[model samples]
Target: MAEYDMQELTLPNEDGKRILYPRMQLYGQKDLEYIADKVSYATSFTRGDIKGLVQAITEEIAHSMSEGYSVKIEGLGVFTPSLGLRKDKERESGEEGAPRRNAASICLRDINFRVDKELLYETAGHCTLQRAQYKKCRRSSQMFAPEERLERAKEFMKKNTFMSVAEYCRLTGLLKTTAANELKAWAAQPDSGINYRGRGTHKLYVLRPANA
Candidate 1:
């Protein structure tokens, strides 16, 4: 059985009225071990064998995706690889001063999954839903002008050698996605007084060097 709740929307409609939307309440996460245990109970194979098979399948899927192929499991789903710019490798072209995007600048960003219809239908058939509680929309009170936020980031970078997206979010009271996008935009502007180092998860914003 699954539980659902009504969550009030933070954003108002054109008539300036917020409405409630249905959302599923997550119970907990089930890891690979849990799946192995469940499968082992229903099959002649041991938990170790189930785990090994699952691991091997995951590795092969990753390998195939890296080689530009999407993998589809019979009753599960299709896994397609998505690409994005590698922050560290991106650079402005000297001619147009626009960022150059090519094979070198791009890397696998994420894997998108499209579940099989039959599997989804089977899961939906087994689900028994009950209403839980009503949730109110909670909006962030920390709102600052874009220019002010940029200045705040610059000031912080002056004292600290580097700042992570999480740190920037805490310092400016901005959401994670907003903070990350702002930082990336600032770093792209050569004279923004902000730059970045590293790539992907290890990326950090830093004060632009005076000479470079």
Candidate 2:
């Protein structure tokens, strides 16, 4: 009974045929409330009771995973905690051939989940699909020329006093690395009217104050 935004994408395989795929839209806590109500009506429990149970389960799952435990819900999935790789870290106080690292060296970066195969298959069978009204699009940012992108960035900096790399990408639609290189290049070109400031995460692009 639920509708999803579906869009047709061309496969780059040998057949190269277009196929409709569901575009997943994000659902929030409000959607969870609706689900709790429906579940309450189906069973004897009240909506508040269902909501409380769901919250308790979520909290418990998080607690277990934090303790380096993998939890599996009967009809759903398994959630496992994992750490991120710190490849760029220099060897700080290590032996001649060995690198010294500890638990503090890396943080718990992700909690991953694997769906239950049976539940996945059954759920997929019940879904209704519909096509999106919008046309399919490739990355339109890729269409922009370097000069055009610089002009767009200049236009953006006209109002804002400073901008982060993330902010620049959001405004100009350029990817992060692309935006960084462009901003640095402009900064190196003396008297380019655009100046880069600050270091690392505190970086910004600023307009020249006209004489000095």
Tell me which residue pairs clash in candidate 2.
Answer: none
Q: Candidate 2, which segments miss by more than 4 Å at Cα?
A: 1-30, 85-96, 133-212
Winning model by lDDT: 1
Candidate 2 local lDDT, 93-158, one digit each (tens): 666868777766777878899999988988889976554332323343565677776776677788
Writing each residue's lDDT as its tens digit, candidate 1 over 31-149 gives: 78878877898999999999999889999999999999999998899999998778767555567767667787787899999999989999999999878532212232256777887
If scored against the real structure, what TM-score would every candidate get?
A: 0.58, 0.49
TM-score of 2: 0.49
| Candidate 1 TM-score over all chains jointly | 0.58
- As for candidate 1, its clashing pairs are none
Candidate 1: deviation at residue 168, Å? 35
Residue 57 lDDT, candidate 1, scale 0-100: 92
C-alpha positional error of residue 63 in candidate 2 after TM-score superposition, expressed in Å: 1.8
Q: Lowest-scoring 10 consecutive residues by lDDT in candidate 1? A: 133-142
> What is the lDDT, from 0 to 100, of the residue 174 in candidate 1?
64
